[model samples]
Target: MAEPYYITTAIHYPNGKPHIGHAYETIAADVAARFQRMRGRKVRFQTGTDEHGLKMAQKARDLGITPRALADEMSSHFRVLFDRLNISYDRFFRTTEDEHHRASQAIWLAMEKSGDLYLDRYEGWYSVRDEAYYDESELTEGEGDEKLSPQGTPVEWTVEESWFFRLSKYQEPLLRFYRDNPEFVRPATRFNEVRSFVERGLRDLSVSRTSFDWGVRVPGTEDHVMYVWVDALTNYLTGLGYPDETEDFATFWPADVHLIGKDIVRFHAVYWPAFLMSAGLPLPKAIFGHGFLLNRGQKESKSLGNVTDPHELADRFGVDQLRYFLLREFTFGQDGSYSVEAIVNRSNSELANSFGNLAQRTLSLIFKNCDGVVPPISGHTDADTALFGHVDRVIFQEMPANYDTLAFAQALEAWIGAVYACNAYIDEQAPWALRKTDFERMQTVLATLYIVIAQLAVAVQPVMPETSAKLLDAMGLASELRDFEGIRSHWYPQLAESDFRLVKPKGLFPRIEMPAEADA
Candidate 1:
């Protein structure tokens, strides 16, 4: 059997229209899943919408519709946007689905059996807007020094009969888990944040709510419903066939990674694992808290009127270009700013000018000079082998860590470095100059370029799928790539043979013009 690798994105809340930030995170996860599969791992990638929560209920009320109806309607919108973005999610779980509700109840029952659950009359400051309870330290002064939620939303006090998870009991265990698996929390900074929060002392969390009727009902209690996070987090397990005896549950249990935003790292990296451990289930292997994408000078907040439609971006810049730019612009696990000018610069400089131009000139030169036929390798040269090593190092050694860390920008940079090397080799070797004086050495030059260009097409495929695919097709090679190891082995050697034809190359990324108002 193959090695199992499971991954998930935090189920998005469908309380509002999809934005570029949502597309950014999904695209990041898509790259990870694609890379892992290329490494020959059995990958399961799950993404979904959180359909039941106070926010969803309120939005539904505002729309004059039932929560269930609203969820059905809003979920379709999210699905459409994801489809347009070409996101490759394996399972799209909805918290309102029966499988999720059953699995959530099962988790509650298991925690109850383990004595990790308790009944209590909860009295505390709660933020229905945030769907979170807050401590004094977690809150800060709003206008006039009034207490606000951590997100800066105003809070209100409430008392109700609720079930609580004994998170306090497992604070030491969680710290020990962090100690045992330091790599479990990602990006170093996010790990430190979780460690700091746990060190400050764990507080028992309210697991159920009595005021809202739009959530999963607590077992044997009509008034109490599971908290949104508790209910939504269970969708991860439910999507894998939890609460039902099945092979998928056994095969993919305990997800390998949960790729989430920095805002929700606590719920995933800390509370989530404690919940699983208390239920006697294995914890996910890792939780990567990736940073946000800011637009202009601020985060892309709808309140600030800065939200950009993902479809518009895709329309303006090709999807593959946008994906490459987003992954290559920001280092993974850190906040990065996005602007039209910045994206245009990257496209023009990196994709269009560097990579696309390399392919265009190489093929054009071959078609014009070599009668559209690949040149045969004639003799040995140390420079030729050394250039091959540079490209080989990127595909074989550097890529794994970059993909493991989700730093696609670095990975793509490494690929671009190889492209730069190939172009420089062409300039230094002067293949055109050698053609008249040393035709044999010129063949060697063309053959060397062939081998590395073939590798580049395969190595960078996962990052820029459509672009890489088109480039490979233009090389008259079959548009299929093997797994990373197979590609590393070069299973099909005929791909770089001398008789291959140089098919016409098309523009992979076209330049975009910025609006004149922004130019000032």
Candidate 2:
């Protein structure tokens, strides 16, 4: 087995239904996990719901159910959506899990023993919607001078006896850490923003709450529950079986990356590292703060009443098409706008037209002209050799790098270029025309085309898994063809100068019926 690689998505709070923004981050992390696994890494991908918070408690109370009951219901919904999106999470933990509770308390005890935790009274602006405490300066003037949280959530004065983390003590340490390890936070601009915030100054953070009972209880205290953010962030460690020092814990203690939305950068980049430092644990390798999904060119949020359900969108467009549109339609680590029109355009133009058409046309020609089998390569011209070389240079080398760096769009663009190259080669070679005259040359052309299509089918599996798997299956490729090694061998004995059986080819992506609003 390869070295262990651990990665996580920010746990979604179970107080509200999931939206496109939530799906975007989860999908991004899923792609990364799939990529890591295909690279032969032992990958542990953890994702689930944060089931403890004031919002959840209130949501539960309003529904006439206990918080735990409500958590079970809401968490299941999130899981169903994940299942629909085919998120291959290794563990779907809930904050209410006994293991998570133990992990949270153990970490709290370590921080307390390290002199980082103290009982104190907190009086500040709090946004239950965000489940965060904000400094007064972090508040901005709202309509009629009603102050609002930076997220525009209405902030109310919250005062309680709580436990505080020695975040102020770690300001210089965090600054030094950032300077020494520039990659701890990603997308240089976001890292710079975090550095600037630290430079401005840090304050001790309230780590436990007396006001909310729906949280992890403090280790030595009964009246206080750990702050929701504190409990939620510790889910990463819990998933790794931390505090007990098991083999899994030792293997994956420092996560490869914490894939998170930009809105939570402060929590993960600032407080999370400090908490780990206080506990004398290694920090994660990276915290990637990717930008949000925009709805109709605006930030997607519950308050805006513009949250698009991912299932609804996936229902209209296929799961793979929606997945392709998300990763391909925009640059990773940057805000991306989405609409029905954009999805339709990308699906019809790229998936249905570029990739699907290329597959169908070539597969049909080979099946009809070459007797529905992989024809033998009798010869190769320089142009034919160069076409295959392009796949080696671009698809095999650069595309993987793009995936490693979370350059989803760049990677897809490269893979699509390879697809187009194959299509252009077939057009230039005119396999159909040659089949009527120069049968041997036509056979060589068809064989080369089959090889290129197989490469693409494997290349896109990380994002469009089901679709790619179907294409590979129809091509009589093995299930083991997902790895780069399998792809590197040009799919091996299956391509070794012999005729192979092929399942009937079908269109991989059917063009969508564009909604009328897309025209706008």
Candidate 3:
């Protein structure tokens, strides 16, 4: 039996309204899950909101509602958005849920059993707004501008009762982990940052806060609730049925990946694994720290009034269009700015012009020339042979390898080149024009075009699901056309002969128009 693959998105902190950043990470995780499924792996994709935290307590106070009520309401909004975006997550685990609370306490108790917990009085620069405590060196002194915190939040001194985790004890072990499994933390930059931080010596981190009572109580300590990061990270294993049943734990305990944002690399890459190791549990296979999405030149900060609502974008451009634009706009692991013009340009030029056009023209020619029937493979030319070989090599060989690296954009570009080549093949062969005079020659060209598209649809489906579905439907193609290995083998398979369905091809992506003054 093959090993089951498991992955998770960081359980989002429900401090306030979620924005595009939340949607972006969720979508990225969804793609990984969907891709693994296409590769024939049994996958568990877990995502949820972090409900218990200092920010939740503050948000509740501001709104004059109980923290439970606020978390309950905001959790619905996240669920609605994920549904709207068509993000197919296997399990959604909330931090406030009973399973999570149980697992959170269990981990704490286990650490206590391991002698990794201690009673400590913490007097440090804490940003209640950030739900994080910082060292004195991390804080700046004085004024509106000079007192900016690391996340650009203003700093304040907080002295409180706290329970500390002996994170310092595991620093050397974590360094050894990196030395042994170098791929544990990804993007190299994130790995290097974690290594440098450990090299500087780990601090015994405050694992609970006495100032707030909205979170999980440090096991046996009623005055202190678990720190938000520690509480939130436990949701991954909690969703896997950890500290509960052994069957689900046995299958998916060591997750294949933890897809997270660059901001919390330390929490996931350093502290999360350390907690698991302390409990004698296995660590996740990889922690991929992806970059943030920026607006124009500045980071998209909600306080600065720069947050963009993802619903508004999804409404304007369709969901998969937004998905395609995001994946294509930037190389993964790099910050990319979002712009209306940029989204529209990619939709029209890349999707509509390049991909949709090829599908439309090819299917149209097939209907016109071959009596709307998918033709049999017969005559072979140098161009036909070369393109088929390229398809075989990419889908069967190259793409499977790149999937491990999570390079979907690179794979998409390669498939786009194949689409372009198929269009160029159409122009050179002129199958529609040659149909009346040379019937056999026309059949060969149409067969090649159809086969090329069948391969393209399978490869591109994880990126643009809706468009790929429509293309296959129009060709009277089987759903098996969506299978990764199925479409890759041969150019012509025994496709079912259905009724001649003439789909009046609507443009999958329409171009965007901008004002002249805005260009300046």
Which model scores highest in lDDT?
2
Per-residue lDDT, model 1, residue 294, is 87
How does model 1 score by TM-score?
0.95
Please rank every candidate by TM-score, starting with the best: 2, 1, 3
Instruction: Provide the overall lDDT of each model, using Cα atoms, as 2-decimal numbers.
Output: 0.83, 0.88, 0.80
Identify the runs in model 1 with alpha carbons over 4 angstroms from their true place.
479-481, 490-493, 496-500
Model 1: pairs clashing at backbone N, Cα or C within 3 Å: none
**Per-residue lDDT of candidate 2, residues 1-520 (tens digit):** 6889898999998787787877888999999999988999999999999999899988988999999999998889999999999999999878889999999999999898899988889998889888888889889988996789877888889888988999999999999999999988888899999999999999889887787698898977998998898889999999888778788888887999999988899999999999999999998889999988888799866678887999999999999999989999889999999888889988998889988998898889877876787787776899899999998777679889999999999999998888888878978989889978999998888888888888888888889999988888788787776678887874544554456676567899988998766664
- If scored against the real structure, what TM-score would every candidate get? 0.95, 0.97, 0.95
Over 212-243, each residue of candidate 3 has an lDDT whose tens digit, in order, gives 78988877788888998887888988987879
Clash counts for the predictions, in order: 0, 0, 0
How well does model 3 score by local distance difference test? 0.80
Worst 10 residues of 1 by lDDT: 490-499
User: 407-508, model 1: which lDDT tens digit per residue?
Assistant: 888898888999899889888998888879998888788777876776887788777777777777777665445456655565334654535676655667
Give Cα distance to truth, residue 330, candidate 1, Å.
1.8
Listing every candidate in turn, what is its Cα RMSD in Å to the true structure after a full C-alpha superposition?
Answer: 1.9, 1.5, 2.1
lDDT of 2 at 87: 92
